[model samples]
Target chain A: MAEPILQVRGLSTYFFADEGVVRAVDGASFDLYPGRTLGIVGESGCGKSVTARSILRIVERPGRIVGGEILLRRHSGQVVDLVTLPSDGSAMRQIRGGEIGLVFQEPMSSLSAFHTVGVQLIEAIRLHSPLSKKAARARAIELLALVGIPRPAHRIDAYSFELSGGLRQRVMVALALAAEPHVLIADEPTTALDVTTQAQILELIARLQRERDLAVILITHDMGVIAEMADDVVVMYLGREVEKGPVDAIFHAPRHPYTQSLLRSIPSVLAEPRARLATISGSIPHPLARPAGCPFHPRCPDAMPGRCDADVPVEVSFADNHVTACHLYTEPVA
Target chain B: MTTPVLEVPVLEVRGLRKHFPIRQGLLGRVTGQIRAVDDVSFSIAHGETLSLVGESGCGKTTTSRCILRAIAPTSGKILFRDEHGDAIDVAGLDRKGLRPLRRRMQMIFQDPFSSLNPRMTIAEIIGEPLLVQGMRDTRERETRVADLLRLVRLPAAYLNRFPHAFSGGQRQRIGIARALALNPSLIVADEPVSALDVSVQAQIVNLMLDLQDQLGLTYLFVAHDLSVVKHVSHRVAVMYAGRIVETAPTKQLFTSPKHPYTEALLSAVPVPDPRRRAHRIVLEGDVADPSNPPPGCHFHPRCKYATEQCRTEVPALTEIEPGHAVSCLRAAELSLRGVASGS
Candidate 1:
């Protein structure tokens, strides 16, 4: 297997609020291999999105990546720490979209209504490559067709508002792939779409990933989406990694109590009809009033009294390529 | 899979259609009609939850509203049964006549944050329904409100606090409590738990089920999530383009679906387990517009099995087995896939 394309080590992002410092991401680490999808799964306020934003040095106001090394291997095999790069420097700007493409849930958030879809695609293409307007327009149409939008030449000239939700998402995918980025970061790309449309989007991503050989970082709260799309999974709670494992192990043999309960809590479509769902004991705690020690100790079903609350658990490998930070799994399971 | 099946239905909707008129010109002349909820029909037995599952703009909410008369439907009959086995034509009733029947049918809205009045305390909000139903004594209303708070598993001490004091799940509980205050025989919950987080969503869904068992309440559960519907509803009705394409017992529908659209929708859902990822039958193209739907089957535009006959001939909802109904030209011939083995 090829080496990892991007590496994150000891990444920490904090939001300096008036009340106190909010540790949105605390000492999180992960590696993204080429052509593989790494899913970051968590509920709201879990810092999954913040971690993605931090990699691109695009954390919003009041929130900044305090410490970390975000290493990315370029096409030339040269490694650079993205965290140390200046926010608006030429290097950061090139890596932000030229090397790493971003796809958000809502296309309108990234695409403007004023310009035509073709115009936006051309802008992205021209920014990365030294292509003329006509050449860029041709590339834009080709990208549109690549993303499976029918009659691309005509639809590309149409405004974004004129397109449907599914069509708009396809356009977003076209725009993201316009630069032929090495890595793709999709944050809930299909959450707002219908089931049929969602299937289309997922298939498109998988197809494009193979065609482009892109490493994908998928951030979503839905475990179902994670299981279907991810090769590796990272489970987060209250801004800390609870478990990191292969997709199969994380789904079938989760080590962390929190992950176990979450799998049980969600009502699976394949389950028997009218079956009672197991529920987590409590809601996600207030962000500012996060639980001490293991962060999920208060809600963990199999939490140990003093051990879970005293301090965070050290990482332990429960199986091949599967590690979890839970007090219950101190030693590797045979 | 055997459970208690009620004899009489608490709510029955027949041939219901809600058409919004598209006006043009200065005088607002009607140009065309958007058949939002066209020829929809379903029944929820007493103490049973029947979910109206569909994508957005498929008339799930519109059908629920027609039952509540929130908006006047263009045509159809809404028969709501009371405790005395009387089936009242809710659609044909005048304002004065409908006012009394409103006590028997209460609606739980999707948004908890906007549904409750911020100015009112928890006691006032839940008790307001009792007052509307003609519970005169102030002390009696207070007693009922406290009972409701306890019934919904909320603390009675929270009665004095405003809605802004609570979280999304807590606010939804308040909405449920208010819907239950009138002793309504049928509750119309439109996406009741969609606004809450996943963990909180499970809590609300389980609470709703528990309440159904305790109070013997019938629910017209409308939602887009089929997984949650399978957990909550006894029967599921799949709607698309404002039509009931399939209606069957939850188990029968999930295990062996008859409609191609049903198969596509079930397969599209991302199975939580990676080992169980089945080959999805993705329906191509956007959902048909209600204003100008396809000639015959609304889903013909996207169905892979569509032929010349399917494009021109609309299939009627036919019952193929006990408590199972489907609408498709190839319902009998096509053996569609379902998530039966949890795969």
Candidate 2:
């Protein structure tokens, strides 16, 4: 592939909690190309959300990005290191909503209940631009229409609560698309909606990608959503990326044990009734007790005895695009 | 069935309706009624798992609550078969009269954290039911709790631990053990695994299936996830508004659905395979309000196959095949699409 639009390298974020320093996101890396969706899949405490927040410098209190570079290839063919930008500086502020638009899973809470949807959306537009109130409102209505909310002109004035769950998510999408961003980061955008509504939101995202040639980083825990939306996939476990590969390679022939267990565990629509699913041996380890060597050593079926516990395993590329971090691959099966 | 089914069904419900009055103003007069569970009827066989699958406001939870008599249902018949092969109208029985029958039917709730008390130990929570039914021997109750712990694959050593000591999956197991303490023939699990992660959900689903095989327990599984439903259920009932739109064997219904609502729901689910980007049938609007549903069909406003007749007439649930039922006016002529069978 040509030069990626966005490159994330060795991104590490830690939270200085009272219990201990939580390595929420440690040494994560990935790339996103134009018009392709990069899916980051993980469970609740696995730090997929923190990785997204790291890109925008929005990691909350007590959480800080200690190291790594977020390289973005600007439209002018110049590279910009997002890590160096101040957290609340004007340049970083423009990059937050202007260059990279982000949407969350729960639109009801992300959106303010006291304000009208129109006001919130226009506020986002007027923040970075010199447009008048009327012009910003018109742009906001145009965005609502773009996201497939019917009668955008009329619905724009309605408060967030007045809309249904699907409509609220659509309005959230409209707010994300307020500025013509080159990359969209949607973190579990459809998890809160019903299945039918999820399908619509997914289709809308795919269509927008086609129309705008945008690079997308789609984050979710559901394998089915990843398969449907992503062109490349990152399987994360315990704040580290266990595998990253082409979508077909990850789904059709996964190299990591965690990835394989995840697919096997899902009660796929393709599964037979009463069919038993294979489960990982233990739940994810508590963050305070981050395991030594390999994070998945406790639950891995193919873990090597002394080798897996000795040192951290670095990624090894098996194919052109597929890479996995496992000790069994390095040490021959005993 | 032609064999007359030697044993009575574990549970059966008929025309269950629960309407909550919307009161307002100083007089607190009833302005309108929210038909939470409108006319609904179905039966669960001796060892079958029948899943009630629908969106949130489609009355699945209300139906479960009505069956358990948590809140007295406005009207209906909850026919529960007793150990003596006698059918008892659970809905009609008074609290004093229903005490004995309550031991034969139990409910497994959806939220594991809130379902179990934090102060209570695992032994107390699981053994509370046996004690409530007049078991005075503490030694026997403790032994039974150990057996229940083994049944759910949890360590018996966890007996003295508080609910907070367990993980989400382990908490759900404790809830299941509590539900099974009295050996009820019927268990109503309302989204038992919806709150869990994907891997943990499989563990609980497998445990439920194993328990059913070992104990011959019948389950009325309530969930909105069709994919999970297809895995554990023998039959699937699709609900819309407050009524069941379709009921059929899980395989038949998933592969060749007769109801348009079911068809759309099946299409809406994302196929895990990247090879099959399913063409989804996205309904155009939100679910209709239960308080003031449309004149005829509640779904006509968003249904793709709605006709002039559908707008003026309500369709009754009719049997199209041996065990397949649908409530659609165009069921006879509409050749709807279904997912191709087999992985």
> Best DockQ goes to which candidate?
1
Ten contiguous residues with the weakest lDDT in model 2 chain B: B1-10
Residue B273 in model 1: shift from native, Å?
1.0
Check candidate 1 and list the clashing pairs.
none
| Cα RMSDs, all models | 1.7, 2.2
TM-score of 2: 0.97
True contacts kept of 2: 0.62
In lDDT terms, which candidate is top?
1
Docking class of 1: medium
Interface RMSD of each: 1.5, 2.2
Per-candidate TM-score against the hidden true structure: 0.97, 0.97
**Taking the tens digit of each residue's C-alpha lDDT, what string does model 1 give over B1-343?**
4455777778888999999999999999999988899999888887888999999889999999999998888889898886689998888887888888888888888899999999999999998888877898999999999999999999999999999989888999999999999889889999998788788888999899889888888899999999899889889999999999999999888889999899899999998989877698877889989988998999998998888999999999999998899999999899888887444
